[model samples]
Target: MAEPILTVKNLSKSYGEQQVLHDINFSLQKGEVMTMLGPSGIGKSTLLRCLNGLEDFQTGELVFEGQTVKADNANWQQLRQKIGMVFQSYDLFPNMTVLQNITLAPVKVQKKSKAEAEQAARQLLKRVQLSDYANSYPRELSGGQKQRIAIARALAMHPDLMLFDEVTASLDPEMVRSVLDLIKELSEQDNMTMIIVTHEMNFARQIADQVLFLDQGTILEQTAGKDFFTNPQTQRAKDFLASMDF
Candidate 1:
């Protein structure tokens, strides 16, 4: 097997007196999709945030795409530029047009010229199948369309890895397919490593290469996706599979 693109060791986090994650360790290879499966309030999102450096982790070493994510200024900025995250809620700028939303970070953070950023943004929107909605405001788009734009914005950063925190959770049933399809496509076509925290078991089965089952802030099972779904080793994972009717 190839060396992992992201290495998470002894990852632990807590909120006040309650611990949300406990010594979480996992490595994600380039071009792989690993889904974090767990019930609500099990710290799935919190783990993703820590992996992406969006939240401070108490004690852990996150080596993302060859660089360590730390409080050091240089490493933090480099790690961030290579990692992108998409939220359950689209989190698009309501006042900005889709194109503007997608181009903002590239132009501001990457310091690309407006023309260069817009060109990259347009291409990304096309990839997400939202090219026609570029000029539209977030309010003017449907929930699914707005999410697609959010995805496009993330892609505009040319991230080597992406953390998706229930990206389809807020969408209507009919709208969920579009976002999932785009993600599936990316997993297939790019050398992008993705860590997704989601409740969509079927989607996880279909798109993820591996699955990590979390329970009470610990990993109960970690295995190949198909094997984990069909024949989980841990009782907790079996119960989760049964609950999902898989």
Candidate 2:
């Protein structure tokens, strides 16, 4: 078996006195897609945020590639460069054009020249089927288009792993499929490694190699995607699937 590209052990998190995550553990291989499924406020998004360094955990370990991730010791900026994230909100800069939004990180953080960054941004926009929207501001685009641009912006950094926190939740019913389709295409064609938190069960079943069922911040079950849907081992998982009408 190939070595995991990322690993988590005994991961836990808390907000003040309230604990939100407990002993969460999982791993991801290169080019693999893992879907996190659970009920609302179950720490699915919190787990993603922890992995991407947006939130600090109280305990546990994160190993990316071969190095241990320490909240205090790790170079967060460098880690973030390797781990890109997209949120439920498009979070695009309203003042910047799509191209500008896409090119910003590469230019400022990666120190790429404006010409180089713009060139790469254009190619990424083309990949997301938003080439013509390059000069368009965020307000001019639909939810789907803006989300795609946000994806392109993340891709512009050429991250090794992508964290998606309920990325499709804000989209309209019609727009959800387009964003999900684009994500599926990226996983297959670009061999991107991703951890996604989503309520889209059908999409998760179709695209994920592994499914993690989280409940009240604890991982109730971890199994192959098909197995998770067909034969959930835990009652919580079963209940979750039943609730989703799966």
Candidate 3:
């Protein structure tokens, strides 16, 4: 097997005296999609945040591309460039147009030229099927369009791994499929490495190469996507699936 693109070993986190995550371990290979499934407050979102350095872990280690991630390390900024994350909220700058929003990070953080950034932004917009909305403001677009723009902004950085935190949770029911479809397309066509924290079981089963069942911070089961859904090995996982059905 090839070396994993990302590895988490004995990972744990806490908020004050309350421990939120326990000794979590997993690895993600290049071009693989892993979906985290769990009930609310299971620390799924927190795990994704920790992976991209948005949250600090109190113990364990995160090895990305073979280098350890240190919260206080000066290279954090550079390391973050390789990990792009999208949140449930669109997080778009309302003051900026779609094109400007997509190009901002590349121009400022990456120091790419305005023309270069804009060119990349346009191509990303087309990929997300929002090329016609380049000049539109966030307020002028639908929930799905805004989310797609946010995704394009993340892709503008050309990240090696993408983390999605319940990205469809905030969208309207009608809009959810479009965004999910876009992500599925990216995984299939671009072979993007992704860690998605989602409650959409069917969608997860469709795109994920692996499925991780998390409960109260610990990983209860980690297995191939199909097997995890069809033949869950743990009672906790079985109960979760049963609850989702009922």
Q: In candidate 3, which residue pairs get closer than 3 Å at backbone N, Cα or C atoms, i.e. clash?
A: none
lDDT of 3 by residue, 1-246 (tens): 999999999999999999999999999999999999999888999999999888899999989998877777567788878899999998899999999999998999999999999998999988999999999999999998888899999999999999999999989999999999999998999999999999888899899899999999999999975788889999999999989882
Error of 1 at 35 (Å): 0.4
- Report the alpha-carbon TM-score of model 1 versus the true structure: 0.96
Where does model 2 exceed 4 Å of error?
Answer: none
Best by lDDT: 3
lDDT of 2 by residue, 62-109 (tens): 999989986863587889989999999989999999999999999999
* Model 3 local distance difference test score: 0.92
Query: What's each prediction's clash count?
Result: 0, 0, 0
- lDDT of the candidates, in the order given: 0.87, 0.91, 0.92
With candidate 3 superimposed using the best TM-score fit, by how many Å does residue 190's alpha carbon deviate from the native?
Answer: 0.6
Candidate 1's C-alpha runs over 4 A off are none
| Predictions: Cα RMSD each | 1.4, 1.1, 1.1
